[model samples]
Target: MSWAEVGQRWKLRLVQVDWYLCLGLLFLLLVVISLSMGAWKLNLIVNDADALPIEAVAIRGERARTSDEEIQVALQDLMKRSFFSADVNQVQDALEALPWVYQASVRREWPAKLKVYLVEQQVVAHWNGDAWLNIHGQIFDAPKRSDIGALPLLAGPEGQSKVVLTTYRQVSELLKINGFKLDSLSLSPRHAWHGSLDNGIMLELGREDKMARIQRFINVYPTLVKQSKPVAKVDLRYDTGLAVGWENAQKESQ
Candidate 1:
């Protein structure tokens, strides 16, 4: 055959090959979509039977406030799904949603089981008069109990939990050096801060430079307390000096 004729034949063969490839790809895409949409329900039944079915769930963690029953209840829906089909993140979220759970991890075990590890919240202080603040500064609510009332109280505006927690830690450490214990700390709506000591002395740390003022008070606290009777309150809003409300005498400055 002539060169041109050979070239035409080769072009026609290439076109035929392309057409076959396109048809094959279209068939594969349709199959995938059908399977995804559950159009072929029989395949689902067959695959589910073949997949590793979750026969048991094992929960491991320190449980003080949260019970095993609570965790089981949270994972009830997960138990319905097979180990391969259940969402690990969803299961973890469910467990963490519990009042006492601080964090949770869920993993699939070999041959049909789920292993869940839980970390319960460790209450550090009373928050906002209603909730509890964990060691990580997260706020959570639980049923009131007598033991919780003894914890140091911390109050602040919404979305200020971390700020309040930080202040509490810093102030508590500073006061500890002076042999005093912080009982409660509050931040007012006007951004003013105040604290009560275990000895019934109150501190008014005004809006700006609260930590600085508190430190200043700490520096002179020993001398001030020794010079006079135990005071009831100290106002640390001044730039150079502080005002003290004595237990019996009029307010004095130092």
Candidate 2:
């Protein structure tokens, strides 16, 4: 072919390729749009079918401090959302915010329902005369409860609850064996240990050998009880022997 005629034919072929490329891109765009619309329609259908919302909330756990009304109140807002669209993390957080709920789990039940399992806090002692201490020695503030007044009172600086609880348990066990009931325990800012018995006797355990000092008190309790006046306080911070403060002495002085 002539050079001019060959150049004209090559231009036509290039134009045809460009048209084919545009058509292919247009076809791919349509397919993507179709798939997206189909997905959106499917989601709409699912939501329409779930118009019933969460009809029931099944709570499964051993709850003593957390009441049924409390759980219902916590989940009131979450129940308005459809099961398919409900936020499980938000539900879990709401339930966990209850005063007694230590941990919570939320899951869908394959229908228009939600399942919530809650773990309640196990209160072991009163902390700082205001808050509460769980068995794990974690501090949590709760409303003033009349039923918890019988629990042992434990006091110490912040972040030392576990240490005070451990010492309380150890010393309480020792005193209980000798018929002494430990009513309260305190850790001073100087790291001294002190306690009060149910019988109104105060104990000064000092900074060291608390167990040994408690043991000494138990050993001498009988001898102290046989005295003429009742023992009001026992100071066991010494290396050997202890000081006894008589209750009547104060009464007579007064």
Candidate 3:
């Protein structure tokens, strides 16, 4: 009717729109909470439900690291009781509690299943004794050597594994896979990388083009071995072929 009245009406319309949006957001939040919650039946559906049995979990479909007797004990505890239900977060926390699990994700897989996925800690390097720092930046005690192989052995001070692996990959490509094995890889503080062979010979691969340097070694190794002249240590830090140190000729006195 009047200018003031028109302005008042506009203000009222804006307030109504804001109220509806707020109501919509509140409804969405309620729906999410409803979908998320599980009726635990007073924690009765999941037997031994307060905290999961970490030792009993078989994440990534792997068998337990402990003995068969231990497994039987877990089964005994599981079966003697009735339903004790748990939520996905509880299961995830249980999985992460294990020493080897790096990180885990748990989700509801609908009416019947609660799915779990785990990324187990990897052996990055052997630290001092038998423990290894994994890829996820956590450390766990390593299994006996017999229990693991096909993994590169990283040697350096603590926390040097990531650096050594970077260099190892560069050098590893040049060598013929059938003829040689990378026994151990090491890195210096300045980031120099070197490796040893099973025969105890050392290889010096300077900071760059390590792949090319390794290839050069591959080309020269067979020829030296054939001549009955094995080099004590081979240095590829030079720009040209190689600087070789020889085993003292038994006839050095001559």
Sorting all predicted structures by TM-score, with the top scorer first, yields 2, 1, 3
- Write out the backbone clash pairs for model 2: none
Task: After superposing candidate 2 on the true structure, give the runs of residues whose Cα lies further than 4 Å from its correct spot.
Answer: 1-12, 39-52, 147-149
How much lDDT does candidate 1 score? 0.85
Q: CA shift at 104, candidate 3, in angstroms?
A: 3.1
Cα lDDT of model 1 by residue, 1-254, tens digit:
89999999999999999999999999999999988778557556533734656788888989788887987798887777766677899999999999988889989888788898888889999999889998888889888766554889999999888888899999899889878899999888888899999988889998888878888888888877796587888999999899988876644333
**What is the per-residue lDDT of model 3 for residues 1-254, given as tens digits with 9 covering 90 to 100?**
99999999999999999999999999999987776665344344455543333233333444434343533343444323322344556556655656555667765443334455666666655543456756643447635656755555666666765666665555664453747867677766777777887776789988887778888888888877776666677899988789776666523734
The Cα local distance difference test for each model comes to 0.85, 0.90, 0.63
Instruction: State how far residue 181 of model 2 sits from its true place (Å).
Output: 1.2
TM-score of 2: 0.89
Mind giving the per-residue lDDT tens digits that candidate 2 earns over 157-213?
988999999999999999898888999999999999999999999999999999999
In the order shown, the candidates' Cα RMSDs to the true structure are: 7.1, 2.4, 11.8
Per-candidate count of clashing residue pairs (backbone under 3 Å)? 0, 0, 7
Model 2, global lDDT: 0.90
